[model samples]
Target chain A: MKLAHIQQILQAEVLTGAGSLDREVGMAFSADLISDILVMCKEHTLLLTGMTHIQIVKTAEICDLAAVVFVRGKRPGPEAIALAAQNDIPLLLSSLTMYESAGLLYCAGLPGISRNPDPCGRAKGERTG
Target chain B: MSEQAKPEQILILEFTLKSLDFMRAGEASSEFKQRLKKLGFKPELVRRAAIAAYEAEMNVIIHARKGVMRFEIAPARLLIVVEDEGPGISDIEQAMQEGFTTASAAIRELGFGAGMGLPNIKRCADAMDIQSIPGQGTRLQIIINNE
Candidate 1:
């Protein structure tokens, strides 16, 4: 689904990256834990998060996320907005709760991202650096 | 592509990170992502490299007194080394366990510290090496294959 459609569905206010509303995002994952987002999300996956910090923007940038939707009417500070703007990462504000937002988007044909478990589960790294 | 398919031109970049600096924590990783993209890495590989580097950087900012993130980019692989002068991990095995975090509540408030950082890095990188001296410091090495 295009970001524009998501904006319409959730009635979200676009805080940044209005120019890229046409970008299509097929999957999304919601989490307040930035670690979970980084661990689970795929490239171009939309992120629905309640946290409004610069780290969210940074996470989007590093993970190459499609965009970020701040749930529960949360609005990030100017610093985050500026960073998102600088990175061309769309930041949207939605008044809906995280669950509501996830449900609405999921019902609209946007699937949630599932982890691709490693064939050998829990592959351990070398102890020696 | 194999290592012999291209010449070894290791491009190096370094960035210093400060403790508790949430505002600037991911800058180095973002820059690394852009560099890899400009160097024509696939999006998936670039994202993995950037995410792994970002997690490593965050570990330093959240737990270390100070740290340096160094990147060595070659044609077939990228190596990220994060060295931090901080209270090193007492038990590397416990630290690598998912959902095992010793982060302060303040750091956790910023939507981090769910104990997934190192595990996430391990998942993203082709290989991860970690060495830590209790009460001294930790050195993390992550390598991501790029063809």
Candidate 2:
């Protein structure tokens, strides 16, 4: 899914890296735990999370995640925003909760971070990194 | 520097990890990540080295009073060593498990302590070793190959 499409679906506000809205968001991993995120997120996958801390950007940079969408309207702090901007990772703010953001993404043809298909029997899309 | 260095020289980057410094928790790893990227290690190797280094750094910051993290980049391998001065692990085996964290509720609030730190580091590293003395401290070493 394109990040622009994600913004449309979640009513997200792009906080940084606005130039890269056309960038393709590969997989989506919804989690608050950084460790689990590191384990599950592939390089360039989108991270949907509630934690709006500098460490999130650090983890995203390390994992090479495409972008981060902050759920529950949790705008990232100044340092976090600066770090993300410096690292060139897109940051988005959304009013939807984590569950809502994840569900909408799933229903909109976005696959989970896992390689396997979703359990709801939704046919998988063109899966590639 | 790469051209002038001796063939057997080990490029060691060192940093001190302060305890519970949430503000700068991931700084060391992020800096090291940039170093690897600048050095042009393959994407996968750079990622694995970064993740393993980050996890070890967090372990020291969260669990120990203070620690030293060393990142060594050789021609064919990457080595990470973190030695902390705090209450060490009683059982290395149990600590290595996937979900056996001892992090406090406060630490958990920051989205850490999923018990995946050590295991995830192990998964990324080509080899690893852990040593600890009760009431003293712990030392963790992990290595990843360039290939």
Candidate 3:
């Protein structure tokens, strides 16, 4: 799913990277813990979380995520917003709870990151796309 | 700085991991990922290196009082060594297991200390060597072969 689609589906407010709304997201993962996202999320994923800190932006960079969506109507501090802008990561805000946000995306056909091997037998976390 | 004949080398990056610095926990690892990308490493290798470095850096910031993380790059190998001068792990074997973390509730709230740090580092690196002394510190030497 494209980030723009996610924004529309969640009625999310763009907090940063207004220019990157069209970026493609290969997968989706939702977690409030930066480390969980860091360890479990794959590249080009739309990460949904309530963790509003610069480390979230930093985690997106490390994990090669597509963008971050702050769930439960949470908003990041100015420093985090600035960091996201500086790093060119799209940040969004949604009023939906984490469970609701993830459910909507999964119902929309966006898969989450999987630790299981791919159908093609590729190793775990390998990007099939 | 070496008088002896030495092969042409790449960059050596160093970063300090501050203890409980929640605001900037992943700073060094983020920069390390960029460096590997700018060097044109393969995407898989870059991701592995980035994950290793990030996990290792987080380990120090969460577990130690202070630490230094150094990256030594060469044509065929990338070496990352993080040394922390904080309380060391008493059970190295236990620490190497996934989901065996000793992180406080505060750290867990930040989405860390899930006991995945050392295990993930070991998974990402081609080879790893760890040295630790209870009440002293811990050191991790991680190598990922660029070739």
Best by DockQ: 2
Q: List the candidate 1 regions with Cα displacement exceeding 4 Å.
A: A115-129, B1-7
TM-score (chain B only), all candidates: 0.94, 0.93, 0.93
- Superposition TM-score, candidate 3 onto the true structure: 0.90
Q: Give the TM-score comparing model 1 with the true structure, all chains together.
A: 0.90
Cα lDDT of model 3 by residue, B41-134, tens digit: 8988988899899899888888899999988777789989899999998999999988898899988887788888888888889999999999
- For model 3, the docking class works out as medium
- Candidate 3, residues A1-129, lDDT tens digits: the string is 788899999999999998999898877888877657756777788889988867788878888888999999999899999988988899999999999998777766677787322333335544355
Instruction: Identify the runs in model 3 with alpha carbons over 4 angstroms from their true place.
Output: A115-129, B1-7
Worst 10 residues of 1 chain A by lDDT: A119-128
Please count the clashing residue pairs in each candidate, in the order shown.
Answer: 0, 0, 0
Please provide TM-scores computed only on chain A for all of the candidate models, following their numbering.
Answer: 0.87, 0.89, 0.85
Q: What is the C-alpha lDDT profile of model 2 across B1-147, one tens digit per residue? A: 111233575677788889999888888888878888887888888888888898999999899999988888786988888999999999999998999999999888989988999999889999999999989999899989877
In candidate 1, chain A reaches a TM of 0.87
Which candidate model has the greater DockQ, 2 or 3?
A: 2
Score residue A94 of candidate 1 by CA lDDT: 98
Residue pairs in collision within model 1: none
The candidate scoring highest on lDDT is 1
Better of 2 and 3 by TM-score: 2
The window of 10 residues in a row where model 2 chain B has the poorest summed lDDT is B1-10
